[model samples]
Target chain A: MIQISRLPYYGRQMLNWGVTIASVIVCALILPSRLPGMELLGIGPNWLLIWVVAWSVKRSVLQGAIAGLALGLIQDGMTSLHPSHTLSLMCVGILTASLKKQRYVQEDFISVALIVFGMTVVAETVLALQFSLVGDRSLAEIWTDHQQIALSSAILSSLWAPILYYPLNLWWEKMNWIENNA
Target chain B: MDTLRRWWDRNWLQVALIGLVISTAWVARQTQGGSLFEVYQLLTRPFQSNPSKQELLTNAKVVEMEAKLQQVEKENQKLRELLGYVAKNQQQAIAAPIVGRGADHWWQQITLGRGSNDGIKEDFVVTAPGGLVGRVSSVTAHTSRVMLISDPSSRVGVMINRSRFMGVMRGKSGNKAVMQFFERVPDVRRGDVVTTSSASELFPSGLPVGRVESVNLSQSPAPEAVIALSAPTSVLEWVAVYPVEKNTDSETSQANSK
Candidate 1:
């Protein structure tokens, strides 16, 4: 196979885009599946939320929000549109980006997982708030349900964050190095 | 003007990419992610449960019970025909494998391998061996999404089969759903069978939903009962999809009801 490093700058950029888009597609595909250990109480990890968190960390606030919005719309397409997923994901992206992890935390699995855990709860809460605003479902029920969802989603997404984060982070870091050197 | 020009020139590629991505996602949302699901269906086709393995899993006892149930159903049909009762037109059901579960934690949904290619349409009734599963929420060319009766947003008009007490049942996000009765003191008891009532415009009446687990008669707004859904939604492998017989009355009622 031809070495990616030897390719022209434009070709390298195109490859970076290809890798990023492929990761998003993979996350989307994995969202609907319940692979044995990945599920808890019939709930799976919030893959899209994890993806948003991953993409948002180390990116600008605007870039993070855009990533969130795009993924959220895709999620809405996968599920119902009334209580849209966009708001929650957008919030996650914005929050993650604004955290400025370089100031306080180091680039490690534990910290990244912690951020994902916190973001998962935030995302679920935002969704619950949207459900409340819709008024179709009872407020009591929404919050009560939110507790279980947030807890499980946080746990699962946190535990699984590194699986998605490590590779994507590596690729983006390499791309950044290549761009700076070129 | 020079600074603005420089910024635009520098960020033009990023701006174009972001716009393209957002517009693509917008198109996906408008089409209910039909293309994505089609790709998902294609990718998952190899992993779908095999029919032969499913057959092996069904033991002889369940088959015997199914045979007996069929006999009783046939007899009940004859009796209803003898009494001149208007028989419901039985539509042929298409069997589909459960290819996926809900994409998110909030919704209780299932993705079936069959779709419009198999004549399944939106709002079609989906049933499993145990009872009513859900209704088809959206359909792609080769895949369809079902909004399960267990979804929190789903509300079904149901009645106690034993007492004929009408109520609206709303899913509580799992196997259990809470039913609020129309009457102040409905004569509902534990273990009573609940089925879709005639007032439900979205579903055919008399389809089995679940059994009442408990009743709280003195509760606040209205009397409520917790129902354990008969369909094993979480573990469902295969389901039957039947076209809903749409009428002008139902359409008007669906609009007026909710």
Candidate 2:
């Protein structure tokens, strides 16, 4: 909220990177919590996935992929190795970035929420495919699980997407404006 | 050559910066996000309350159950002693506060506040008041990540306590687990108790897991029953992590026995 444009170019750039890193950290720390209303059934909202989607909505393809890779690996650290999260997240990143939201979407919150809901289903599908390919569990079992997780995760993530998307969207817009006007 | 040099000069910092970010993320992944949990432990320190103060909340039913279990255990110990069966040492447990939930939904996991600094290690079995919760999968300096028994990938050798019908228990998301009996028509019924068998490599023998909620004997390949986890995996606030002392021979045999 402070006057970013008043600062020197190097300082502004440093502050921008700081904000980005801090946001990622916030998302990571909240990944394991089941706070009051943040959970549905036994599942909490996918914070990192939400962050990646918010990041890639306005970025280039390359940038989105990179963000996805980093967040995915961190998520892998938190979970297990097989059926890696990298593929699902990377796919989400590229898809969201390629949408190039500024031109297509009209309403901010609703569109972001819609994108988040769809992306959650896609991400879960990618995970299910990985599990199936690994040949660990029966195909029937995997799909049945896929249906429940995808629906619940999609509903929860989209409902909570605005909480993360709004603040991050505001910050990015402010920084970009400062870069143009300063 | 001059153009190449100019490009490198313009982009060297960006390349190096991105490389740094990426390499750091990779290291964090390799270490199981050690640094992140350390920070989480620090941030949540103020919110954790004393566990002993909850004695007042222990209802009469639980107290009565505890007394009955203690009596049974005492009789079992005396019988084992008379039979000359060598008993394994009961290792002490380290109580840790649950700081986080699974990073992602696909895998059911929890993060504990105690880690290596407190002598916690990977593969330590965690338990809540009702029964077995899960086992530690990764450990950092001040935090450890536990793979809950409710994860689909988690399969533990279990037996129906009433009938001793051996089978494998598979975790479903949430607190439900599906147990497949080894015999075609096992003597399992609704509301039967399930416990970890002597064959589970990742957990100790005879740990209370959950109760049978429903039974499906007609499933192809094997009979399956749904178990309602008693540890409250969906609402766990704290757990006790016990160190595993049995060495390679015992662990390998149990692993292969499955």
Candidate 3:
């Protein structure tokens, strides 16, 4: 916002990275809190999942996978480690990025929300699968939990996708324009 | 070699950034996100629960304490006659604000503002006004994470206070848990109070856990009961933490009996 176009090339790059990293940190911090309007059934929106969908929607598959891996590791730290979050998030990243490549959906708020809804289900299912394979819990219990979690998370994440997507999309668009013009 | 050098020049920064991010995340995972919780605690310090809520919690605490006193008194009379047992002095409790809930919905956990700095350590028992909440799982300098009894993986040795029937309780998500009894035809009924038994090594004995919601005696090899946890795990504003009294002799005796 502060005349990013007027900055030196390296300065602009630094600002871009800073904003990107800061947004991820904000998502991480919000992951554990349940604010008044952001909660449903004691579950909050999956901010990291939404962020992964947002990032992967416009990036290469490799980049998306990397973002997923990093965020998933951080999420594992915040939660437990036995059923790692990396595989599920990485699956989300790759699926979303490839969905973009196949030209299945256009770029818009609704489309992004739809992608997030589907991807949240995908991510949660992957986690449930991991839990099943871990064999510490009953298969029926895991799937039952999967149903509740996936539905609520998909609904909340899709509904709130715009709040995160619009801003990040705008910032990336502005950064792209400035870089191309320079 | 010329083309490779050109490619390196074009993308060295991106590669380096990716490496840095991955390594940072890996380090965070290894430390179990201790530094992240520390920062979260600092940021949310200003937005803690209000004085009005604290007052409500205090009033609830008083009623719960009286109920707990009545239960303990009844249990004490029975135990003294059966085993000639003597009660030990209780340590002072450290009260802490509930800072956050579980990071993921799948895990039922809570982060407390007070930590090792305030004498809270791993496995320290946490209780709210109504009853047992959980135990401290990990601790940073000023923050500690408590794994709520509602998590699927948490297993606690519990018993019905009325009949002295022993069972193993596992979380069923939300504010409910499933307790499986050792004896197939154990004496249990709806509305029976459940508390921690001496068989549990992770928590102290006799802490109130929940109340029996229903009993399912014919379902399986071991009779099971559904317990509705007394602690309002979803809306807890504050909790009291006490150090676990090491009862090695009791633990060994319980193990021998098993």
Candidate 4:
């Protein structure tokens, strides 16, 4: 463990990726848990969504989409399959990566929080659309339920975005700095 | 040829990584994150309160209620025997602690600490203090996921105990449910007790669900009654899971609790 930092550049890169993977695993495990201060009206922060946003905010469009797809599938594994989370999360990834292209949103915590807020509502809306399209439930019921889900999810996810973003952003920036200097 | 080789050198690793990630995710989605739940169970084991220990900590009032319930259950069993009806299952109730809740707000589910290792299977009914809570949706070796009745997607066949009026009850958010009556006008009162009907294939019949909170007539498709669930849905700490099996014989009762 002491020699880890002195390893070759490739080993360091591998370590960085390993850390990234571990972070995803941590988020997945906590998705089902409603730990204290992490819960709101029986809803916890959308951890996977947070992970996706953090990943996509600085990556390329393709990288963002891939992260979204993978995390969305994992979320589906945690919850129900119908109206799969894939489409919404993939869309979130693409939009977020593109949102960076315009430079309209700054890279501050407040802007990140705002982005998470908008993205969560979009993700939930896509899910509600799929539910309505399935025709198993009534339209009125789906929309009303959508309203509750979107608001709570948006509020909770936005508030918790910084907790995840800070560390991940720090590591990614460090890795970028290393790669650039080397 | 030079350009092609250059492109391959530049992008092969990224493409391979993406392929690997996508396939793993697909598998995870299909398998319902079995390994993740296992890890979660392992991590949460130290934190979860022991069910047996919780039972021992029960107050005098609950012990009294249990005694009363056992007496009524005995009477019901005897009455069914007298009527020449055979019971369906002889499975024991597995006590489980609620370890986690739904991954998101859209799905109303809770993860249980007990699973197949504890004899819990899919479709087993879960109940809390007051009445029916939900059904077991998925299970890993040591953890089971329950799809709650309060989810909008969940539909249960329920009846008014007072008038025997039947209806299909669909879950609304919170502790409320809307029961759509088969009859145009159902004879339901505000305080009428509701129970699972015999027609429901998923759940055992006659299990208590909730009490009628309001009766709504002149609705679009059919008259509906709003029920306030007796079981504590939002704040469930421990729940009892009863194993259910398909009934081959013409047995009326489900739990053959001998």
Per-candidate interface DockQ score: 0.83, 0.73, 0.84, 0.83
Better of 1 and 2 by lDDT: 1
> For candidate 2, lDDT tens digit of each residue in B1-258?
999999998878667767877887898788878898889889888887667755667789999999998999889989998998676677888988888888887788888889999999888989998899988999999999999899888899999999999999989877899999899999988898999987666777788999999999999899999999989866566788898755444766879999
Ranking by DockQ: 3, 4, 1, 2
Task: Report the lDDT tens digits of candidate 1 across residue range B149-176.
Answer: 9888899999999989999999998899
Q: What is the C-alpha lDDT profile of model 4 across A98-137, one tens digit per residue? A: 8873377565798889889999999999998998889887
Error of 4 at B86 (Å): 3.7
Candidate 4 wrong stretches, greater than 4 Å:
A1-6, A105-107, B87-89, B245-258
Pick out the ten consecutive residues of candidate 3 chain A with the lowest summed lDDT. A98-107
Q: Candidates 2 and 3: which is better by DockQ?
A: 3
The candidate maximizing lDDT is 1
State candidate 1's DockQ: 0.83
Evaluate model 2: give its lDDT.
0.87
True contacts kept of each: 0.77, 0.76, 0.75, 0.90
Better of 1 and 2 by TM-score: 1
- In candidate 1, which residue pairs get closer than 3 Å at backbone N, Cα or C atoms, i.e. clash? none
Candidate 1, backbone clash total: 0
Candidate 3 chain B: 10-residue stretch with minimal lDDT: B50-59
Clashing pairs in 4: none
Give the per-residue Cα lDDT of candidate 3 at B100.
Answer: 95
Best by DockQ: 3
Give candidate 1's error at residue B172 in angstroms. 0.6
Q: Interface root mean square deviation of every model, in Å?
A: 0.8, 1.2, 0.6, 1.1
- Clashing residue pairs for model 2: A32-B100, A32-B101
Collision count of model 4: 0
